[model samples]
Target: LDPNRLPRTIDGLINALTGELDDETLLIIDDAHLIDEQPELRALIERFIMAQPPRLHLILAGWHEPDSPLIATARLRGEALLIETADLLFTSDEAAQLWQQAGKTLPVDFDELMSFSAGWPLALRIALDATNWRSALGLREQKSKPALDDYLEREVFARLPTPLQRCLQRSAGLRWITPDLCAAIDPTFNSSELIAELRRRRLFVEPFGEHGVRFQPLIAAWLSRRAAADPEWVHLHRKAAVYFQQHGDHESALYHQIAAGDPAAVTTFLPLARTLLAERRAEAVLDWMRRLALTGDETPELIEIQAAALHQLNRLEAALATYRRAERAFAASGDRLGQSRCLRGQAAIYLDTVQPAPATDLLRRALKLLPRQCGAERIELLLMQAENWAN
Candidate 1:
């Protein structure tokens, strides 16, 4: 039975089970780890097991023990059968059979192949298919990086379709991808299609419920290298940045946009920095501000953002310096609003450093700089002056 296309609903599961069964049938659910997170499916499976005739037996095989509610329910009624993958490893005779199947004469070191493959069925199968076991053993012993890359490249990447290859490239840039972002990247893509394509190609894409997907660390690293030289590297980064930004993941968005080297990322990150500061995520605000300060192009707005972040982080000396720089830039640009903000940020720095006297003086000067009818500006300055006096 194909576990991949298993019936999702309780009635569907029951009908499928009844139609597939004969007298005293043994129903095995392999890779039980895959269904552990699906509580509904697990409940349906449990219901089927409970409703089954006495002649039916259920066997579950998985790397990890199943943690489903069904497992607990079945255990309460003493109905669950569990077998671990470790129990399926080859014995001495089975190892000999595998070696023989690979068309190799049994040497004293024959069992080393099993040890090298860690007796994993898939790994053992792949090793056996590698031209000759003896030669492959020799290469494996030498620890040749090129040989390993070539083996994995041919065995893995060479089998993927072009679109999947692109998907993998994007996935490499991310720790995880949401379904919405994946759909954005590949217009025709869906979760099931992505899973099927990756599984069919034997690529290491791991599905996490309905919203997330991941790739093996090694595969992701390799795909990252493969994508480094692609002409669309910048485009992919920008696309990922946009997707992440749309999802309100500003940190991830900033990372991709920084990789793309887009100066406009500074503008994108400023509001994010403010939000982070508001959330009291000071460390993250500091990080984004530092990146924006270092990587972003020079502008009065960018400098003001850097100054604001520095102020929030209690880097009073740095904030003061940044405010001075922004003040000069604003003066040169004749931007009175920018100049007023720089002055206010400088005053805040002074207040942060226990210099409330100077801070009050700075706020009074800033208040005079604005027009009398600027009610919002006057109210803000009044509040800041009151805070300074309270300090």
Candidate 2:
């Protein structure tokens, strides 16, 4: 009966076990993926399964689906049941019960915790048992969580095949990964197959929309941090930027461009800013500009766009300051049309604030900057000037 001297063949093993079992018995094989390459052991298990031994139950559990013929046959016959990650996820009630066991109540922001955990038991445990559960779920940039990192490195990432590992890490650069996006980033790998493998492994990859999937938030944050340190970080992000832009996801494109630290982010963001401002998403435009972190080299057009966005957001003082800066830059560059646009923006802001005198003065300066051929600009400036002077 010694484990070290177990019978090698199926018949020998069944014979050895026959006399020892009288009642229903259950045998569970964990890490079944490890035995996938052991043909002899696999064959023995296949034979044992086919025999359908009475009063015996078998459970094979692992991250991967085993490549077994008997299992496939049994699946078709409805004789074998599978419990996936979704089935095993902890519900809110289950999470509450865990907290009850710890002599505490669930946090008020329970939904956010759920997002961080994605119902994974290990993640829930880590968050629940942390010194500050909020801090644990923060998963902030450049922060270290030895427990989660060790588990992901040893059990999750290290266990993956090299190609799959690379695919997973590279795909983390995108907010929502699609086959086309992955193909753009890493052409050598079959993007669909790699994503399918990650899904099969239950590596926190979840269906996002019709054409996209996203890694669980915590896993994504961790993987993004790791990917940032990779040599392909810039290349991957650049590719993602191009893909998102091609797909007409301009916001995501702007995000990736800024993330890549590309000089072209400003150029890419300028047109998108106008759309965002037109849609009254002025705050979003400002946020993107903050991420861009432009120094003193802003193009007059970009400054005017930023000023307009600020004005839309009702940040009057900031808008006034930004518009003035744009006017100075345009004047320095000898762009009379650009300078006129800035003056008009400033005049509108002044008019909004009920300062007609300043508004009329700004519009008068704007009219001076436009040529006779600039018919639209002259007409717009004159109308503003006449309106402000009449007021």
In model 1, which regions exceed 4 Å deviation?
1-167, 196-210, 215-222, 242-253, 289-297
The parts of candidate 2 lying over 4 Å away from their true place are: 1-9, 15-22, 92-110, 129-138, 143-147, 169-177, 208-212, 239-252, 295-300, 307-391
Error of 1 at 349 (Å): 2.9
Compared with the true structure, the alpha-carbon lDDT of candidate 2 equals 0.80
Candidate 1: RMSD over Cα atoms?
Answer: 14.2
lDDT of 2 by residue, 171-246 (tens): 7677877777777887776877777777767778888776667888888777776777787888889888898888
> What TM-score number comes out for model 2?
0.75
Error of 2 at 245 (Å): 4.8
lDDT for position 114 in model 2 = 83
- The candidate maximizing lDDT is 2
